[model samples]
Every structure is written in C-alpha cells, then in structure tokens.
Target: MKEQSSRKGFAKFTTLDIVLMAMLAAANAVMTVYLSQVNQALNGLGGPIATSTITGLYMIYGLLAYYIIRKPGTALITYGIGAVVQSFMGSAYGILSCFAAAACYLIIAEAVFAAFRYKNWSLPVMMFTGGAMVPVWFFFAAQMFGYTKWGTGVLLVALCVRIMSGILLCGLLTKLLGDALSRSGLLRRFAVSRAVES
Candidate 1:
C-alpha cells in the first residue's frame, strides 16, 4: 500500500517544524546562560555542586528534539544548531566546543538509535545518550577553559555532576517534550505506523 510505504507520511516536517526546532535552540541557549549565572551566584554558598553540570541541561534539548521528530538527524541538527545559536548569543562554553559537543550528541544518538531499530524510545537510553555526550562537553571545557581551579577534586566532581545532569535533566526533559508533542498532533505520523503494527 502506498500509504503504508510513505515514510514522509509518518513524519512530515515543514517550515514550522524547522522554525520550532530553532526556537527551541534559542530557548535552550538562553536557559544555559541563566543557569550558569545562577551557578556562579551560588558557588560560595556550597549548594552541593561540582565543576559544571548545566551541560546536562544542554543535552536535554536534543532529547526533546529527537523524541518529537523521531527522525535520524533531529537530535544532531537541533543541538548542533542550538550551540551555534548559543555561541552567537555569548555562551560561556564558546562556539567551537558547543559545536563539537553537538556533533558528539548527534553521532552517539545515531548509533544508539540504530542499535534499537530506532524504536526503543526508552528513558534509560535517553539518559545514556545524555551521559555519553557529557565528556565531549567537559573535555572541551577542560581544554578550552582548564579545570585547575577545581584543584585535586576535579575528576570526582565532574563525573558526579555528569551522572546527575545526564540521568535527570536530559531524560526528564525529553519525556516532557515528547509528551507535549504527541498531544499537539505533531506525532500523528507515529500513530499511523503503530496502528498498522498492532
């Protein structure tokens, strides 16, 4: 059946789709700047923190994008694009590493999704993807900004923050955005496929 064979029908994205993705990127960029400021303000208060964890929230954007689009490049494109937007908006992470981390997110996500036939769509996997992207961000940060300030406890602090941010923020944000997209009829394409599968 032509209807059954139409991949486009299952996920037909338009200008609105692209625009929405870019808007999300901008929103995420603004969020990062705000979060960083908050982190800076609370540094001396010792609110149980580490090197830098907002990168976890950064990955959340990809999670949400991929979840909604259910497309191969959605995670990669949106996030990479987001970073570019973030840099132009004056991100502390800089344009280069933001792009690098975005590339890593996209690549890792593609591999993960492929392994699952692109149908697993589970929370754990989302967290794994988020965590996987952590090093890219941290390493980039360390290289560009240096972690000497954190002293002898840098590794422990960085890893802990990675675990917390990746597992919690990215995964939760993905679930939230995915749910919202489904409710908005944007995921109708998925519904058609599942109905036939059942």
Candidate 2:
C-alpha cells in the first residue's frame, strides 16, 4: 500500500476535501462582496494602482486552499470555484470575466509551483507565485478595458505596486496564517501540518 505521506494519491480528492473546497468557495464568495466594496471605496481615491493593491487579498483564498490541499491543480479548482461563486454573487464584469481571470491566475501559480517540482513552498517561491498574476492581469485588463490607452509607463507602475502587494499580502500573509493554523493544530490532517511535524 502507498504510504499516506506519499504524494502518489495527491491527485485525488476525498469527500472531506470536496467539503473543504466548498467551504473555501463559500468563504471566497463572501470575500468577493467585501472586495467589491473595498474596490469601490478605493477606486475614486486611488485609481487602478490602489485598487489592484488590495487585489493581493484575493490571492489568499487560493493560497490557503493550496497550502492545505497540497495537491496539483488545487489552486485551479479552488479559485475557479471561487470565480463561479463570485459570479453568482454578482460581479460587475460578469461571470465570464471572473472565470477567465481565475483561469489565468491558476496558470501562473501552477507554473511557479511546478518549477519547484511542487516540493518547495519556500518564501521566494511563494512570493514569485503571488506576483505572477500581475502580467496576466495586465493582459486581461488591456483586452477588457482598453487599458493600453493608459500607456506602458503607467501600466508598468501599477503592475509593480500589484506585485509588491501580492508578495506582502498573498505570500507573507498566507504563510503567517498557515503557520498559525498549523500551530493551533486545526490543520492537523493537512500536508502543511505534516510538514510542520517533520
């Protein structure tokens, strides 16, 4: 029999895993509403840069899910579900855009994780994945909102701010939260907890 600690069965999801994903999806739904309000509040005062800064918080759902699940495609499945939940909750950009954005984000994150062979969840790796969404976001925004008109300089500046936000909020904050949860023994069944034990 394959040892429980082995990654051989990591590709499969258990009923408990499905239930956890659903709960995370629901949490993401709440975050979407909260983020919309935060975006609205920041929009007039801070423009795209300010708004995107807060977007790092959006990465939390995927990060937390991935940390716990520690499975290939976990980010894709969790965040894709998050987008659907957000769409049903009513996104101004519509359901399709949310889905597309989630898909793009997943691609970036998966690439980063894959680069490490999904064995190293080091800070640098996490930070790289956290910021990976910026390029994808820039392309998607240009297509959706004619953001190209803003000029490359302005866009680049906004992207930098977003990357920093991702590093701090998504990468650092997720690590902090994961550590706290692991320490509390609340995540004892998760891979992260096992990693901590080892």
Candidate 3:
C-alpha cells in the first residue's frame, strides 16, 4: 500500500511535464545565446542601464515553466536543464557562468514558491518571485564584471531597473503566456489550465 501510494504521488510529474520542461530549457538555451550579443551591444551603447533593461527576458523561460507546471521544483529542474543546454549550446558566458546563472535563478524562485507552499499563482506572487530573483545574480554579476567601480548611484539605478524588468518581462509575461496557452487548450492537462478555468 505504501509503495502504491508513493508511485501515485510520484506520478504528479507526467511525461508531458518532462517534455515541456525539456522544450522550455532548450528554448532558454537558444535565447541565452542570442541575448548575450544583444547585451554586449546595449552595454556598448548605453552601459549597464541599457543591458539591465532586458534582464527579465533572460529569466522568463524558467518562470514560465513554473507558472505552467505549478509544481514544486519546476523552476529548479527546468533551470538546471537549461544550464546544461546553455553550456552545450555555446553560451557567451561559458559553461561555468551558465550554470551559475541558472543556480541563482532557481534558488530564489524555489524559495519564493516554497514559501507560498507552491499553491498561489496570483499576479502579485509572480511579480514578487520574479523581482526577488534579481538581486542575487546581480550581486554576482557586479562582482564579476567590475560594476562596483561604476559608483554606488549607478549600481543602485541598474539594480532597480533590473528588478522592474524582472517584474514586467519575466513575471507579467509568464502569466500572460500561461493564460494564453491555457486558453488555447495546449495546457489542458497541466495544473495551470485548471487554475485558469477556475
């Protein structure tokens, strides 16, 4: 009876969940490569501020997967897979940095959802989760890229921009995309589809 119950519980993550996670991770890997070039161009043009504006886009895929899956460990697992995929796909930041970035995102995302017991999928919750994920990676990036020398005021401004970008581009965009997918019936078997219907 215990073994049967364990199997039933483990069945929460179905084949579709694995496929969706893999697809999103691959997509994230591709986007990461493309965005690295964009980041370089923006950095040259308007410095950190310009590059920070698109920070949220870098984080969306994992959040979108979490939003759709509405499951514990969704962000972490997707991000881990994404890091592996990014490393193999020729990330500009190289292999270690790709995994580092994924680690930073998953840590915060997992904490936030776990705090809510992974039950709340409201817009505010999503925005908070997205915005909250920014600072840790930003700190690491600042240290790595010598952004600390840019003066405190500039660093603060860039951080703020990144947070706002996280809220809008990652959080809001995930919600919108999840709802659209749910409405189109593509996510009918996912928890998000039922949430949307209710």
Where's the lowest-lDDT run of ten residues in candidate 3?
A: 5-14
Query: lDDT by residue for model 2 over 50-164, one digit each (tens)?
Result: 7878867877778777777777878778888888888888886677778887887788877777778889976777777777766786688677977778788888888888889
Residue 150, model 3, lDDT: 92
TM-score of each: 0.77, 0.89, 0.93
Clashing pairs in 1: none
The runs of at least 3 residues in candidate 3 whose Cα sits more than 4 Å from the true structure, single-residue gaps closed, are 1-11
Where model 1 places Cα greater than 4 Å from the true spot, the runs are: 1-13, 51-53, 148-152, 184-198
| Model 3 lDDT per residue over 30-129, tens place | 8887899999999999998999999999999999999999887788789999998888888776687788889999999999999999899999999998
CA shift at 119, candidate 2, in angstroms?
A: 0.8
lDDT of 1 by residue, 23-105 (tens): 77888888888887777766656533543555477678776777665666676668877878888888665677678777877
Model 3's TM-score against the true structure: 0.93
Clash pairs of candidate 2?
none
Residue 124 lDDT (model 3): 96
Estimate the lDDT of model 1.
0.68
lDDT of 2: 0.79
